[model samples]
Target: MSTLEIKDLHVSIDTEQGTKEILKGVTLTIKTGETHAIMGPNGSGKSTLASTIAGHPRYNVTSGSILLDGEDVLEMGVDERARAGLFLAMQYPVEVPGVTMTNFLRTAKTAIDGEAPSLRHWTKDVKAAMENLKIDADFANRNVNEGFSGGEKKRVEILQMELFKPKFAVLDETDSGLDVDALKVVSDGVNRAAEQNEMGTLLITHYTRILRYIKPDFVHVFVDGRIAEQGGPELADQLEDEGYDRFLVKA
Candidate 1:
């Protein structure tokens, strides 16, 4: 089974004031077919953990380790991590002005798989995946997220997850700007990816509303850059009702 392990991870960034630590000591494990939801308030270092795992240059790993099936993830570069089956769906997906979605998707799939997919089969797969996400056919020809709405950008991210089929995916607050319908559609796409590929998922969010549609096998409450508590789905319900006041007080 595919596994991603984070052990006492500490990350920092160079701010205007100087270097500031973000992730204090985060340790977690996600195995194939297991979904882990990370819930916390703003500035709690949830995104730091995600970005660190994805090899964002901005975040410097001050200590600890990240392993993919016992392989040292910390040694891999950003693209190398992608090839190692690590995918990050950014909260704010950037626009690629000149690149069409079709070329971008195919190129990315090729890079991850190390071989070009059959054009005929690739086209068919893309069409079906887009249909499942309610993406229009014309989007394939459009510039990637050039002028797409917030919901549309989020949908495109999910589309990438479906097509690339990463071993582990870090969805950084995917539920941020989605409406109820958009949320459900995006959630369905995520569910499909996990179920079909047995892809391990690490879902980061501030609110518990998303847990309703994308039920997590594990729930971790992040506070002050560390996991304050962890439990089953019922923990999410408790957090929904009680909020993070207790955790904040402890922090």
Candidate 2:
């Protein structure tokens, strides 16, 4: 099975004030077919961890190693990372003004696989995925995420995840702004990918609501740029009941 390993990662970003550390000595390992949920309060560096893994240039890896199947992930560029099977569903997906959803998906698929998918098969797969996510077929003709609602953008994100079939997916606050129905729909897509592709998931969220649908094999509590605590799925229940007040008190 594939493995994504983070070893004592320290990430920082330059701000108007100065360079500020976000992830301080964070380490975690995810294997294919495993789901790892990272729960924490706001400003706890959960999103930073996700961005770092996806090779966002804004977050500098001050000192650490990110390895995917023993290859140096940090050495790869952003597109290279995607080609390496690392995927990130951003908290706020951006709009590509001129790129239609159909073209974007096909282009990305071609880039990752190094060959364009068969037009007939690709069209069928895209149609099936959009229907499963309840996305309107008209969205195929629209520009990527252009003028889409928050919920719609999120659905499109999951749609990309489903089509890409990455080995690991870092969903940064994917549950944010999603209503109950949309949450279930998105969660179902994630679960489907895991079952079908054995995709390892790094789910970052503050609420345990998503956990109810997308069960995590492991739960990590991030506070002050480090993992303050971790446990099984039971830990998420505790967080929901007790909240991060206890962890914040310590931080």
Error of 1 at 235 (Å): 0.8
Query: What are the per-residue Cα lDDT tens digits for candidate 1 across 1-251?
Result: 99999999988999999999888899999999999999988999999898889988889999999999999999999889999999999999999999999999999999999999999999999999999999999999999999999999999999999999999999999999999999999999999999999999999998888899999999999998899999999999998899999999999
Model 1 worst lDDT window (10 residues): 48-57
lDDT at 179 for candidate 2?
100
Residue pairs clashing in model 1 are none
Please, what is the whole-model Cα lDDT of each candidate in the order they appear? Answer: 0.95, 0.97
Predicted structure 1: lDDT: 0.95
lDDT of 2 by residue, 1-251 (tens): 99999999999999999999999999999999999999999999999999899988899998999999999999999999999999999999999999999999999999999999999999999999999999999999999999999999999999999999999999999999999999999999999999999999999999999999999999999999999999999999999899999999999
